[model samples]
Target: MLRYRILKLRGDCLLSLFLLTLIFGLILRIISLCRETFNHEPLSKAPGGDVEPFSLLLIVLGHSRPSSLQRLLNSLSKVEWLHSRVDLRIWIDRGSPRDSLRVAKGFIWSHGSKIVRIRKVHYGLLKSWLQAWPLWDRHDYALILEDDLEIHPQVYQAFRYLTSKIGSRDVDGVIFQRLQDIPCGSFVHFASSWAPVFSRRVFHDFVGWYNARRTCVPGFQPFVPGHDKTYNHWLRERRDVWSPWLRRYLYEKGTVFLYVGSLGMVHNHHERGSHQTEAPAFFVHRKIWPKVEWNRIQECVLQNSPVFECNNTQDGVQCGPVDGDRRALLRRGIKGFLSDKLWICGAPRAV
Candidate 1:
């Protein structure tokens, strides 16, 4: 009887081991499939698949700094697919002299490639993109980047995924997933355009929108919001204004809204002396401008003016041209210390 019991126990142990091996095999197979599906395969590094040609419209304006520009170029170099095929359009700031731009050209050319085209336009941070309005027909998608962003290896994958998911809709904008606001407790997800990929139709919509309000939000306005400033306000205001329209228009057109980069791989560095700068030393306190009163004032201004010029004055005295020059110096100095810090990344700094 004891011998019979031992034989039964051995049989049970063998069966358990076999089951464990089978389960392990299933897990490994699932992992392999997932790896194949989600792993980035740039066209330059892709396997036996038909190469999809992607034309890049990269714009760099006054925001360009040497360290930041170097970082941008480095990250862009990792884009395996569009190495030689990139149709770059660099719009240097008008304030940045021809000599500065020439130096920029030399810097860009040193990277084993040349910018397919270079256009010098009188554009600040926001005006840079505004200038591209006329030239939107040059590509499938427009990549509007500041000089300080270093993107991830999977940047192309994210773009392709967005294009596939969003389709050819007019209102469908792909948000390139680098955000300062933690919308939820997650590694990555999409909400809206922190860095947007503009399609042709969407570009037109932006132009139309800009044209309609361009008079109010003119290019040279001192208070013209930076990219993050615009994004934050757009998010806060879009639920009542743009979001529903986007959902209806894109959804009706069979395109879905998507965001990528939950891992924060797209790093936005605010190099000092760039076009993006914070308020003067005095504009950093909350008691000076309470949120409730500030919102009320903002609503009043938006409703009353819809578009108005910036107040480049203090104590009823014009700060004049010297203010801009002084601010430029401050901007350059701050860039080195605060390049990748969140204090100035996703939203307007207190000012």
Candidate 2:
């Protein structure tokens, strides 16, 4: 009887082991099938098994302070690009320090391609900042950066997201500004050459409008709701200044410059020979992240331009004046940042 009981126990153990093995094999097979069906090609990839990344021109303007320029270039070199290719165009104004020229000319860009433009005559800051990026057929978007500041590693990521999400047609371009009132994210009337991104259409139109306004538009009048004495004075007096006219353009045409770097992407060193001498609390607060929390940036994008020309001014212009309901830019709409037209690579992947 005992022998019979022992044989029964052995049979039961064998039956349990066989069942466990069969279940484990089934799980492995199911997992492999899922991976084969789902993980073949991610939606982020471009077609033809080659990711044709988005292209833009990084027009780096430098004239002096080799250290500042080098720091900025190094920061740019360390940019974490996901699917964007940046072609570098370094424009050195004439009469620049030889050290600065050496730093720019000697630097090697590994990403896409590079072109260094050394002007015959000094273009100065205004012309260098304004005209460094022309209506080049080679590229549609241009990010004009100064050598006085160093950008965060994820600066490209912010630019990528903002360039893709154009909330309104009247958006002049994306700018990297940190406002005093709305610290997180908001649009502004100010055309800050500080770290502004301009599209081909906006820049093309701006060139014509700027020429006309600066030439024909008489008497630098105060345009902002409050006392605009400083800006108006700068427009009239400062010939080498460019941002004043850009501010005028947005003010008159009622366009908005998208501000995504409200949390601070640029660390302005305010080096010698730079325009910005007295760095404000806003500009100095250069808080950068080691690894960018994309979700936080997405929230900031959604929080963009709650009001028209959402600056520190007192106008309180509502976004109703603009084209669409920008507040509808919840997570439900965008799968990811698309092209300026929101067409290419804007849709969801197939189920």
Candidate 3:
């Protein structure tokens, strides 16, 4: 009888263990589903099934300027056209001061509906960007904006226009604006700092490449042929501490250079005293960052010279047509006329 009782007890214990295992499995599945939903969940809906499924991630550095951020927030609030177009996620550095943290929290809370989350972390900008990478998998497109940006009202319209225009085409990337002084209608295969939109395919591919090749090369070279510009840009900016495999990934398959568009969304705040001293100062006092700064960098790269000059207007330097002949260009063509031919939007008689 005792032996029979022992067998029954063992059977009961086994059944209980099985039930617990089942419950644990269910819990894990639920957690995973919630994570996926949070990451790639549907964005704000529009009528006619045209709503985009993307996340606009605003990654603000801990030491960002308040006035600049406030202006950026104001722009965000006044984005009337894209009322329900994106899911906004703001990632702020948690190691910031209490006051800054409160302000960041306040900003997130105020836009509670659109704001998916306010991730607080203790890291620098580059690290913070990596921290936000997981969220990218959940989004169709991601717009990585910094705190100190002053965007034009039509920024959203411009971004939507580019995305629709560049659908699945293997161009580098699109930027609201660029620092390089390429011809007005130059073709780009990439994007820049302002408000860049990345399809999931592009993001995954580029980041995957970046991961594999970021550290291998000693300084920076094209991960492969035709991609020298992108890799070198990182080298110039002191971010080339990646592996050779990452470099190779970025430069692979004749991905020569990424292209950019000449719309206006991102503007530098160097005049407001936020000069990125960490980066080699390329632009002079009067030139715009995108129009003049990047071109100088490019010139140096082309010449294979570590440092180059903005000597005159001919080589698309800082003193080039954009600056030297703004008024003439404004009167010369319809495109120029439409551009308002100025650095910042709505500036007083700039052209």
Top lDDT: which candidate number? Answer: 2
Writing each residue's lDDT as its tens digit, candidate 3 over 86-114 gives 44555556543455445555774232223
RMSD for all candidates, in order, please.
24.8, 21.8, 14.5
**For model 3, what is the alpha-carbon lDDT of residue 333?**
31
What does candidate 2's lDDT look like per residue over 1-351, in tens digits?
A: 999999999999999999999999999977754443223222233212333234567889987667777878888888875545567778888888888889998999876567777889988876776687655434556778888777778877666655455433444477675554553456555556566777667776666765654455454332333325545555466545666556544544455556675657776666666465454312323335467676667676554455434433335222223344433322212322221222332232110
**CA lDDT of each prediction against the hidden true structure:** 0.41, 0.60, 0.43
TM-score of 2: 0.66
Cα lDDT tens digits, model 1, 145-214, are 6655666655554454334322334224445543343221121112232355666556665445445433
TM for every model, in the order presented, reads 0.46, 0.66, 0.52
Question: Clashing residue pairs, candidate 2?
Answer: none
Candidate 2: 10-residue stretch with minimal lDDT: 330-339
